[model samples]
Target: MKVLVAVATRHGATREIAESVAAALGTALTDAGVRSQVEVRDAGLVHSVEGLDAVVLGSAVYLGHWLEPARKLAESFADELGRVPVWLFSSGPVGEQKRPAEEPVVVEDLVRRLNARGHRLFGGRIDRRTLEFPERAVVAALRVADADNRDWPTIRAWGREIGTSLARLERSVS
Candidate 1:
């Protein structure tokens, strides 16, 4: 399968998460001994998803909402996405607050309406040193501590599951 992992990010945290997801997927496919392709791109710039067997769309949340470009990509590709398999993820929750879902989230709901197979939430990062003056003040006022919350093992597991699911889908279609 050819999988595209498209994500929108700010402060580069989300991009790092997206890259991890893509790498995990690539490793999974290789381990499965399957001939597959995986690529990562910024959701805002992906003009086409043609010939892809699966797509994973994700975004970084800001103020409890996904970035505009990520939402735009999902909305614009809704029709094409419905015809194939899709997964959705978000990199947002910080610190110990980041946990896997036991219920549906808003972005996941949107993904479901677009026919996505699953939606996931991954922990994000916050670097106090990298924040601008205004951003720094906001974090301080909000009492947000600086940390990298990404979980590599969890990400890899999710990718393996996606690869397994897509492989099964391919088998069924064939």
Candidate 2:
């Protein structure tokens, strides 16, 4: 099995999430006795999805919006992506309090355009030291503390689900 995990991240939090998902997915596929090759790449750097059995695409959400690179990737590869099993995820919404209840505005449209099998929303991390002007100012204004709010268990479970799906798919085809 061949899988691609393409992600667009700002300050690398979303990338970390992508890595975790990739790791878990790889482990699960191994446990299922399905030999697999999974590549995690920057969404902007990927030019094609040829021969990929599945794809997991994700982006970092900022102010209810997905970063431009990810959106462009989906738009650029819509036709090719639609032919395979694709999953989507968004990483953002950080706080000591409850995570945001709203999904990124563009998620639904991309999911439909790509015929994505599912979408997940994962909590994000904020490190004040990494922030630039407006973001730092905004964090200061909102008094949002620097923290990593991502839930590993849920993220891993989601990855395992995709792995399970792929194993079933492989069996059906064989």
Q: Relative to the true structure, how large is the alpha-carbon lDDT of every model?
A: 0.81, 0.92
Tens-digit lDDT string for candidate 2 (1-174): 999999999899999999999988988889999999988999999888899999999999998999998999899889999999999999988887545578999999998999999999999999988989999999888888888889899999999999999989998898
Compute the lDDT for candidate 1: 0.81
Those runs of model 1 whose alpha carbons end farther than 4 Å from true positions after fitting are: 96-105
Best by lDDT, which number?
Answer: 2
What RMSD value applies to candidate 2?
A: 1.0
Worst 10 residues of 2 by lDDT: 93-102
Error (Å) of candidate 2 at residue 40 is 0.9
Q: Give the best candidate by TM-score.
A: 2
lDDT of 2 at 157: 95
Could you tell me how far off, in angstroms, the CA of residue 101 lies in candidate 1 after the best superposition?
Answer: 7.6
